[model samples]
Target: MNEHQRRLLTAAGLTELRFDAPMSECCTLRAGGTAAALIDVQSIEELRRLLALLTDEEIKFLVIGRGSNLLVTDSGYSGAIIRLKGECNALAVQERGPDFALVKAGAGCALGKLVSWCGGQGLAGLEFLAGIPGSVGGAVRMNAGAWGQETGALLFAIELVDKDGRIRQISVDALRLSYRNLALADGELGSSILTAAWFRLTADEPEQIRSRCAAYLERRKGKQPAGAASAGSFFKNPPGDFAGRLIEAAGLKGASCGAAMISPVHGNFLVNTGDATAADILALAEQVQAEVFARFGIRLEPEVKIIRDESCQ
Candidate 1:
């Protein structure tokens, strides 16, 4: 962002800003170049103000959750990065009926935190998110799921700000989700920011909810690699077929390029052994896709969001 724009942001009550923020620090992949600016957005009001400013000035910006599913390239991002904070991270019961409760969760709330909160409140249906590592907003935007439960399926409504800085609370009918993809029916995925989500979860015994959550976490841990730097899964599962199965069947279970490797424990996971650059991971993923396609005549699509250098893109 330019100096005058920075001054405008400050005057707009959105002051936590850093110029040339390193994306490596922002992403879970632990490797990236830099963002032109990084702003810690503190509230819904602050978010609206910033969005208005960016829209008016024609500045590009991206609202990031926990950055778990993101892979930013070494050449860097050309826009500013906005991280939600304050009211954007709050969670509460919006309404309660006899059989179900509507829960409001800020987009910035950690998925794990929401899961734990659900378990504590005896809310059923979100146990599948036990081990997911992104923010609620990210999860909803990406349609994150496990064990046949997708986040989009449970959400009744979503709050977001459009590209023009208009805040909206759209119905789930406006959300189009399939496999691991989520897009608003309005087609605002590129510029709109998901601010919060409301989920309709049925009531259950707290102990039961917790038990189910634990089981899901256990299954995830037993199957996926633990304590290694990696996105949860690399490829989307094809119809009636698992990506991990194809990857392993193609003999890429323990493949490596530089520090990046397809996990031996789970063929779907691409890991950074220590110093894997973003390019290393992308190259490795591409190799997986090519080999799998060559062997099975099926091309694998990445579930991880690869952030390319805008210059090259």
Candidate 2:
């Protein structure tokens, strides 16, 4: 962002603006350089205003949620980074029927918190996502899922603002949500910022919902590395096959490059053993992919979002 844009944002209720914000603090991978600017919009109005200003100025910007599935490179992004706050983090029950309830959640609300809230309200259908991390907007955008329950299954509608600063509401059917994917009518991803999501969840006993969520959490704890600096699973499961199985079968378990290592417990997880760089992790992931392809004749596709500077080598 330039000096004029910075002044304009400051005058337009954007109080929090940092120059060259640390990208490592924004993601689970904990490896990144810096961004040109990081601006936190505390309300929908603020977000819209900022989006308009950025669009009018033709300044490139990216909206980020909890940053759970992101992997920023050692050489960070040069454009502005936009994050939501305030009303964007709110969650509440909009309507309640005899058998189901309509729950509205802000895009910036943490996915885990929303799940816990739903469990407390005896809402079913989101228990499968008990252990996943990220924000509601991010989850809906990616159609994130676990244990066969995807985000789109419960979604009823979404309010979003497109890249051109136009706000609109779209039904769940309009999202075209598939396995780990959500696309606009134009098939373009990240061209819109989801402001809120509405979900229809069946009313159940709180204990039952909690129990189901606990079981899902237990399963994740048993298979994935706990308290490790990593971006969850590295690769999406291929058709009729699991990426972790292929990685493990290819002898990539416990593999390391610098301080980045494919978790011994789960071959698909790439963990940072302190001082791990993005380059190191990428190198290890590429090596594992090559080995798996050579051994199983299947190429692995990464699920983690990798961010890199265009000028970086």
Candidate 3:
């Protein structure tokens, strides 16, 4: 780390710092270079200070969630990676009406845990998140969805630290939402770090909600690859067609480059068989994209967030 990096930490009073934290360990794909630092922020005040310093210094950074839907390059990130924890993962539920209830969750709350919590609380409308391996913040940022439901649909409001380090509460109606994307109405995309979210759910039988959640998980396990190191659903579905179907039609299933391979069970998954590098995964994805475009005339967009070290460029 340079002077700016050291200064950022010292000035912010952040303690949980890991220098040169390996992206291979942080990301679900299990590959990539080391980050300059990974800081586990413990409170909103800490985050505000750190974010302000980061902005003042013009440092590039990522406010990571569960790191499930990210792919960092082998050259690694040159800036800090901030992960919310401690009080940032708190959960609270309140009865709003006869059938309506409001659930407040910290951005760091695990999607699976939130789904389970909702089921235990007899809260419906979150069963679609049963098996998603990420945090609420990531889901809301990407508008993550499965089985015909998206996270944006259940959101009432969200609290986030803006680029200038001002925390603001924005309603769902004030945002521009679409397939796998949630953009700020008046700001640039990714200009804030989500701290918490408010979800409005309807009451239901706990047993029934649990059963529905279980069924979704079971269906997900049956359809998607299991126990493989993969960034889930690598490509977004083009209009009127699925990326997986396109990859399959292009005969790219089970294709390998180094230790990286397209998952045989699900064409959308780019898997690390064992020791695949970030380069291997990226190369395979590009190949898949080329082939799919050549055969179908539709370019598949990536759903997974790809982070390249700009310094290397």
Candidate 4:
């Protein structure tokens, strides 16, 4: 590590930080190389302090949640990796009115667990998020949605730490959420961190809510490939058309590029059948996009975020 990074690490009281931490162990895809350094921040205060130190040193860092929608390169990241898995998992029903309640969840709270909690409490709006595997912060950033409902729909407001380490509140409208995208600007990219989100949900019959959530979970089980290493749907559905349908039509199902294969069960999903590398996944994805474009004249865009080393061509 550089002198500046070494000094900053010592100053933050995190001298025991992991060097070359395995990226595969932290990600859902179970692939990729290691981070140059992995610092686990377990509290808001620690996170704030760490960010301050990193910013002062001008270190490039990334805030990772559950690592569900990520693809790190085989060569690994050269900068520090900040993770908030255990620390930012607080979730609670903060307030309740006559007909609705305000539920507050930390950014790192599991999206599925939050939905399950809401469903158990007879909350109606979060049933659609029951099976989506991601952290609440990542969900909000991705505007994650399934079965026609999105995270932004229930988000009343979000608490974030700005670049200057100042805590700020941004409302749902300010997010400018679209399909699989949020309003995280370039300046606020890694500098700002999502802390918590307030969700507004209506009171409903518990049995009905449970039934709906169960149905959603069942549907997800039927559609998505389970018990496999994957990053969920690889491509966002093209406007007025489905990416899976296009890929399937192009005869890309079960197509393999090294260890990565377009899932035979779901065309939009690329699964690592053990021993897949980031390069393999990228090649498979590119081939799918190319074949789909050649067949239907529609270009498929990746929903998964690819983080590669600068040295990677």
Candidate 5:
């Protein structure tokens, strides 16, 4: 099935397909095994065609962007990995007024780059996402937030492809966006592939917007570990209490399992100390969950998407 899909994709004009592609190069964690195949898609037409081929051949696939929040297992993925490239990296202002503007961005645009673009253009409201990692698609799907503002608050609409290959323009309300999650009309989590998104932002002085971005970046620098391999915060804050505070309160800061450790700089962060394996990280996370649950009665939920399956090996 996978071979048939690959041949079809190649015949359809994709030449950047790789077999046993290194996952470490793709994810932020910097530690993961190879995948079965990785396909670099250049345009929407190519994606549509490739997805059709995969669907017809019954080959399992996952779409990825920047791979910031992904944690791949050491055993590797046994399915196709589709990555957006080229034309999907666009960011442009669709409509502009004295006090507001509608910025339309491609799904593969880096969240940080989008924020920076807005700052440079004197657009405000996305300053909170200044240093946040991942692409616009991933941000929208996860409702990625920082400070007090979330991605959903600024999202006006999204163009996404449904399971049946139907392209739909959905309003923010239709997505039912919530804290770190998006839901469908059926009350289930959404799995649509986002192609682009429109965000509403207020017009501000570029200097003012840059100042706010600087402040946010500085705050992140002070609180989060820099120059290390990590998937941002390991766990989401549970309700009113922060996961960092809980893990710190449980005395797990700087705790280690092999080379993976709870960062001393931030208890909510799990860092890969050069040689940490996915298993090591998972073990440390489990230990942190157990200790925090026992002490504070709050079971920490991982924010990082741990990609693993029976076929990982």
Candidate 6:
């Protein structure tokens, strides 16, 4: 560990700190290597203090949610990992209009749980996100969507803490949401930390909303593999085309690279067939992308967020 990490450990008074906390323990894929340091913040104040300290020490760090839709490198992250699992889980409903309600959710709130809660309360507009597996903050960051709807469409505003730990609110219009991208601009160190989001929803019959969510869940079950360690969809669907169809057409289904196989059930999902590493999944993804490009001349883009050393190779 570096000097900054050592100082953080001493300041936090944490004895359970691991030199290399295994990446597999924190991600949905259950793959990847260790992080330089892992710290769990359990409150807003704690998160704020930690962020301020990191900034003062000039230590690079990342804020992680539930770790869904992410892939870490086998070489590992050489910076501090700030986990927001227990700290930002607040969720509540606020009145907007007679027939409309504003759903206020913390960044760490489970996306699926929020969807289910809204659906059970007869709230519409979140049904399309019924099967997405990630935290509310991640969904907002990625503009996560399904079945012709996106999280950005219903979002009223988002609360964020900038690099210097200053809190600010940004409206939906400022979020330049397009496809799987959000307003969180790249290239800026410690750009912003999503705190909470407010979504507008319309009231409907509870049963009707539940029925829709159930149907979407059923559809996902039929299309996605169950009981497997996979990071959801591997690639984003190209415009007017599907990634699954392209991979299947390229005959890359069931292709394996060191126990990481393109799931036969769904061509776009790469599954860890027990003991698969981040290298295996990445290799398979590269091969699939190459083959798909070779056959159809359409480049496939990954939906999974890869966090690792870009300078590795």
Off by over 4 Å in 1: 1-13
The sequence of per-residue lDDT tens digits that candidate 4 reaches over residues 1-313 is 5766866686678523787898998788888988878887777787888778777877778777788899998989877887775557888888998889999898988887888788788877988888777899889888899988888888899999865678888877666778997774333344578888999999999899889988988998858888889989999999998999898889989999888999999999999999999889999999998888888899899999899768433
Q: Which candidate number would show the highest lDDT if scored against the true structure?
A: 3
Cα lDDT computed for each candidate against the true fold: 0.87, 0.86, 0.89, 0.84, 0.85, 0.84
Record all residue pairs in model 3 with backbone atoms less than 3 Å apart, i.e. clashing.
none
The best candidate by TM-score is: 3
Worst lDDT window (10 residues) for model 3? Answer: 4-13
Error of 2 at 180 (Å): 1.1
What is candidate 5's lDDT per residue for 1-313, written digit by digit as tens? 2566556756766857888888889988888877888998777777787777776777777888888889888998887887878888789999999899999998988888898899889899998988888999888878899998899899899888755577888887777877888676556544467889999999999999999999999999869999888999889889998999999989999999999989999999899998888899999999999999999888889988888857655
Q: Which ten residues in a row have the lowest lDDT in candidate 5?
A: 183-192
Off by over 4 Å in 2: 311-313
Question: TM-score of every model?
Answer: 0.95, 0.95, 0.96, 0.94, 0.95, 0.93
Error of 2 at 230 (Å): 0.8
User: Candidate 4 at 284: error in angstroms?
Assistant: 0.6
Error of 6 at 121 (Å): 2.7
Residue range 64-100, candidate 2, lDDT tens digits: 8888888878887777888888888999999999999
In terms of lDDT, which candidate is stronger, 1 or 5?
Answer: 1
In the order shown, the candidates' Cα RMSDs to the true structure are 1.7, 1.5, 1.4, 2.1, 1.6, 2.2
Off by over 4 Å in 6: 13-19, 184-190, 310-313
lDDT of 3 at 206: 96
Per-residue CA lDDT of model 1 for 135-183, tens digit only, reads 9999999899889889988989999887776888989998888777788
